[model samples]
Target: MKKTAYITGGSKGIGLGIAEALLKDGVNVAITARTQNDLNEAEKHLKTIGDAEVLVIKSDVRNLADEENAIQQVVDKWGQLDYCIANAGVGKFSSIDEMSEEDWNAVIDINVTGVFNTVKSAIPALKKSKGYIFTIASLAGTNYFEKGAAYNASKFAIVGFSQAIMLDLRSYDIKVTTIMPGSVATYFNGHTPTAADAWKIQPEDIGQMVVDLVHMNPRTLPSKVEVRPAVPPSARK
Candidate 1:
């Protein structure tokens, strides 16, 4: 029997890439996004990849009830969840003085709280299967930048939260990993991904890493991975 993976925000970008990688490896996958249209599109695209069972769930991780429902749906279909990638995140870049409370809350709700909800909802099933949990953070989580107050805060909180959970769940044989990537060429923050941005990380790179991590021996847990461009634009210039 193939292992199962549940990925949040799996409709596009990094989440989708990871889902594709898992499917290619014969892992059953359940992906969630906020829009049904995106979910349908992802389902269609994923079907072309491999024979693994695919489930597309319309979900907003910011809502606890929705998170619970998404997890339940995956469990009902697959019977058990062997891995979860909390890849759903949002960003609003603005200086602290200009950042609205709404903007800050929105970032925090989806990045930090959303992850919490995903992990909490899946803990029981994960515990049973000794599953892995991967959280997609950012370099901004550790390196502060101008006009990145909201995004930085959320990512930083995610790093701290995931570390604590790693310790908390280790006894249960559940492995938690925090993946922090630098800039990637994705349609994030209103910018469309393009070939010009190829120098940056690709969603599939992160996805592949997740697959490798999942297959690693149980005794070796690589709990933190920081990925960045081998040579950044400034270096090229």
Candidate 2:
């Protein structure tokens, strides 16, 4: 039987890229996002890529019920799910004094709590299938900087949470990995990806990394991965 995967925030950027890669590998995929139009667009593009089936679901990861329904939908359409990616997140950059409570809540709620909701809802299926879980964290999770209070705190929590779950889930034969990346060339943080952004990591690059992880030997698990651009703008001559 073909394996199945679920990806949150799958309409574009890293999530879409991961969907494409998995489809190409003959994995049936169900992608979810908050926007119906974006899901529709991503569904159209995904259909063109691989022979495996594509299902687009409109959902918000912050809502546990929504994630539960989305996972049920995937199981209804496909018998088994082999992977679940908690990739829906947002970044709010500001210092402690300048950051508003609303902004802080949004970041923590979506980035941290959203991930918790996704994995919590998917745990049953993942345990049954001995599936894999990928939490898309960031280098900022470990390395903090100026003007990064909210984003940094959220990511740091994600890294810690993902690691703890890895230990908790491993006993059930489920694999959990946290991918921390830096300077990805995507629409993240409202920045447009143009030619000038070519030097940064591309979404597909992260997708390819996921593929590699999937194919890795079952005995060896890379619990956490840190990836970044080889030559950042600061390093360019």
Candidate 3:
């Protein structure tokens, strides 16, 4: 039987990296993004990487209705949902005083409430499949830094949220894990990946981490994974 996964914010970067890895393993994948063009491009590229059927949906994680409809469409097509990944997130770096209400809401809405919406919508199908849930958190979630107030708060909330849900879903044979990564090379925060970023953790590294999680023995559940580069930024100097 073929596995099926649904990922949010999968147009590019880490989410796309995960999608590519899953597709390479012949897992039917449905990826969601807020824009139609990004989904279109992702679908085209994803087709070339793997033979698994690809579904691209334009949906915003911040919108509960959109999240529900997207997951419903995936189940409607595949008849089952094995994994739901909440990889959609946003970051706005500014001092507490400099940040506007609009910016704060954007980060919190997409990072915290967005995961809530995705998981809530996916639970019915996930329960049926006894599926897995993966939340792409960050090292920032645990280690707070200056100017990271909003992003840190949101990710911190998700870390606690993921672990709590793990306990809740375990009785039904569902597994949940939050992956916290440090300094990954990706097009995040309006910066593009370049050769200088070779020292950082590559997005595909996290992708492979997800693949490994599924391959683990069913009796064993690793609830939280913290990944970082072999060398820190300071060490590179």
Candidate 4:
């Protein structure tokens, strides 16, 4: 039976790349995001990559109801869900004193609470399938830096949360892994990828990692993974 996967924020960047990889493996995939236009574009592009079925859902991870409904849609369409990637997140950078309440809340709400909702809503389905869960975190989760107060706090929370849940869900035969990546060449933070960004990790790299993990021996679980560029730009200079 072909496994089914669901990805949040799968309209672009890492999410889209993951979807393409899974699709190539013949996994039926459902991808969700808040924007209909982005989803439409993603759907079109994804279809060209693989023959696997693709389901695009318009969902906002911050809303529990929306997440619940999105999962339900996946289960309803695919009949089973073998994997879920809670890749929906946001980053807001600013010093504590300079950060607006709105920006702080948005960061926490989307990055932390969003994953909670996505995972919580998918638990019942995953339990039945003994599936896998992947959360997209960042190196900043552990390393603190200036102007990263809000973003760091959220990613840090995700790393801890994903680890705790890995323990909680293991008995159910479900695997949870958190991927902390450094400097991916994506449209994240409103930064367009240019030639200068070639040195950064590409989204497809992360996608390939997920595929490898899914194919790993069931007895061995890599619960936490940290990825960085092989050679940073500074090393060349």
Question: What is the per-residue lDDT of model 2 for residues 95-167, given as tens digits with 9 covering 90 to 100?
Answer: 8999999999999999999999999999999999999999999999999999999999999999999999999
Better of 3 and 4 by lDDT: 4
lDDT of 4 at 51: 80
Q: Residue-wise lDDT of candidate 3 within 1-237, one digit each (tens)?
A: 899999999999999999999998889999999989999999999999877899999999999999999999999999999999999998899999899999999999999999999999999999999999999999998999999999999999999999999999999999999999999888889989999999899878888989999989999998999999999778876
Candidate 4 is scored at a TM of 0.99
**In model 2, which runs have C-alpha deviations exceeding 4 angstroms?**
none
By TM-score, how accurate is candidate 2? 0.99
The residue pairs that clash in candidate 1, if any, are none
Give the per-residue lDDT digits (tens) of candidate 4, residues 1-237.
889999999998999889989999889999999999999999999988878899999999999999999999999998889999999988888888999999999999999999999999999999999999999999999999999999999999999999999999999999999999999999898989999999999999999999999999999999999999999978885
Residues 23-77, model 1: lDDT tens digits = 9999999999998999999899999998898999888998889989989998898
**Model 3 residue 109 distance off true place after TM-score fit, in angstroms:** 0.2
Sort all candidates by lDDT, best to worst.
4, 2, 3, 1
> Residue 17 CA error for candidate 2 (Å)?
0.8
Question: Taking the candidates one at a time, how many backbone clashes does each contain?
Answer: 0, 0, 0, 0
Q: What residue pairs clash in candidate 3, if any at all?
A: none
